[model samples]
Target: MRRSLRLLAACTIVALVCCGCGTIAVRKTSNVLDYLYPEGSPAIPARDVTLTLPLRVGVAFAPGGTATRRGASDWVNATAMGGEVTEAQKLALLERIAEAFRDRDYIASVDPIPSLYLAPGGSFDNLDQLAQAMGLNVVVLLSYDQAQFNETTNWSITYWTLVGAYVVKGENNQTQTFVDAAVYDIPSRALLFRTAGSDVRGGRSTPVESPEAFRAESAKSFEEAIDDLIRNLADGLKVFGEEATTGRVRGQGTPEIEVKAAPGYSGVAKFENGRYSGALGPVELGLVGLLVVAGLARRRSA
Candidate 1:
């Protein structure tokens, strides 16, 4: 028992060294999305004076499958254990995005029609019929994938233990992720956009002597990986015309964000709306602090 306990403690420490706080903070602190579809942009018919957007979209699980997670609970409690987002959650993501566009007077709607994955028998042909039934113009299909690196090697120094760590995300054999995305122009049958999430730390496994500790550490990566994808899509959509929808949609920008940190602390702002565009680091809000602390506690327990 003593040996087991000590091993657990040591492994837990090592995991924390690699994981930091292990919790992603999704705070859209402040952002303002405003834009006009330029005549140069994709031209579509303005059926009504209101010009309802051909804005039907989807939220799906990673194209193939989600990496299996053992030890602790998944990064997002709401996300299903497997790689897929729940039906309700997918709907929610699309709905919120639709609402955002609508708030800006861009008439849009989320197709009630399930995605190809959700409806196996349903294909693009069926989708056309379904969209026509709902009076939808274009349909957008979305998916996501992620990769994480939590490399921590241990070496004994002359007097102290050295835990070699690389917490910042990287792609390698020891990573976990969820990714894959595509946008279809139902009207023109054109491929407006298609891309995969950053599979940086592809298939790299974080094997903790303590599975629980490893999970606690890995969950943060998983959560943040997904959040990063979402934020990229959201912010990219929010800023529409300033940049191409490709690289930006996949989080390939030089700018950084400013967010809010711990109490009595100031951090980087999370999102980059038309009003503000840049990169954001970790936040230090009270809620996030609690989460981080909890991860720390879990690490300690491990």
Candidate 2:
């Protein structure tokens, strides 16, 4: 009986040591630079850009790291263990972003583009094709980087006992996420503006529950970061509008870009020389006509 007890004690010690001996780290990311300028920046002659009002816009997630270069469809499967961002999640997030621009006076429509439509490291030519196919004048690309680390805490020693692995909160998880949005004029290939957001979260879970807990934490971190991105994006949009209107967007020497209503759009607004020109709408025009007739009748009576 004494020898048996000693052997069991030694086994427990080895199990406890093994439980806390290793750390697990996972990383997943999508990079806009890799997707848009994979061959490095190319030199092209500068030309003035003409922005037609009521612009059609497209939004999409950029392809992830080189491992996913096989195509975006492979991303989920390849990074499954790392808690890959799902297509459904991407669509929902894109819809929220589209809603932000959909009601703008200068925007006609905002479409959420699927990652499948984009090739990894396809560059500007890919965007050109997408724009032509989708009738998009402007495009917004979203990219993200996330890292998660799992470590055993001091409480992990309890995991030496089989039941403790299921009941003791011994695993510590840390997740960090960052997301970015870049707006571009497809025709001109000019970067109009950009915005970004990030978040970090930490929690402890029982060893048996660590996988689920880590995934949940990662998802929550992404949602929080995106919320922040939206707020910052709104501010960036405002600044871009102000700069574009004042002719300061591309600097002084650059020719002012013309802005006009699309061929069939009925809105009576125009932009010339970097200034907004508001014209009377039908209701306003009718009111002015009534006032003119009233004045003429009063003059004849006098």
Candidate 3:
């Protein structure tokens, strides 16, 4: 009987040890390619692009296969396990992006669009509809991918004691996030430029606290990645402007660009071939000419 008891105890211990060595992983992603080309890749035709000055722009997040809203507990569970981005979060992020372009002279307005308006794999046709409805000439789409993994360390064996589950740091957790922004001209269906950012974070946590810890870390990672993306986007805009001015961007029959003043804009501005000139209006020009002629007459009399 003693030997049998000892054998049973050993088996129980081994089973518990095996059970402690488990892992959990979750992934959530919104891919632009998947949203734009659901059926398959289609050949895109090149077309001319006319860029009106003071462009009306819209920004939005790409839709993925997930619910847009959830309860508090559901949100905690979802975020802890790398679930989809919520609608509220998307709006907040889009607002931040809009601020980046709001002050630019070339942009008339930057509007935040909700993901609900777009369907996955909607392609250019969907964009065309949205552009028309919103009076937007350009659109910026944001997509993201996030993953979280949790695994038991060798020290996890202590979790069997119950108290150790709360006090022992035996869970290894890692979170990785990536975000991308693609700018497109709505009329021509042309991809003007794109920028991206990514981040990875890792830490150890007690088994009981892993869920909350993972959630916090995941949010932090996304914030950091977005900051990086904004910096890169600024650089990309500068480079694109330079290229457009040099005529290099117009190569390969990409798109023919024409710049014209927006309606209701009274200030005289001339933009040709991606270059801006003639800042003065006709009225100002006339005054300057009059001053020059008057000065010339005075010099002759002297």
Candidates' TM-scores?
A: 0.39, 0.74, 0.74
The Cα local distance difference test for each model comes to 0.38, 0.75, 0.74
Which regions in candidate 1 have their CA more than 4 angstroms from the true location?
1-102, 111-117, 120-122, 147-178, 194-223, 234-302
By lDDT rank, best first, the candidates go 2, 3, 1
**How well is each residue in 72-185 modelled by candidate 2, as lDDT tens digits?**
111012233345678787888788888866766667889999888999888788999999999999899999988877777667767656687789887777888899999878
TM-score of 3: 0.74
lDDT of 3 by residue, 209-270 (tens): 87788778877887888888877887777776655665434455567655567677643232
**Candidate 3 residue spans exceeding 4 A from truth:** 1-21, 65-82, 248-253, 263-302
Better candidate number, 2 or 3, judged by lDDT: 2
lDDT of 2 at 271: 23
Error of 2 at 236 (Å): 0.3
Find the 10 residues in a row with the least total lDDT in model 1.
27-36
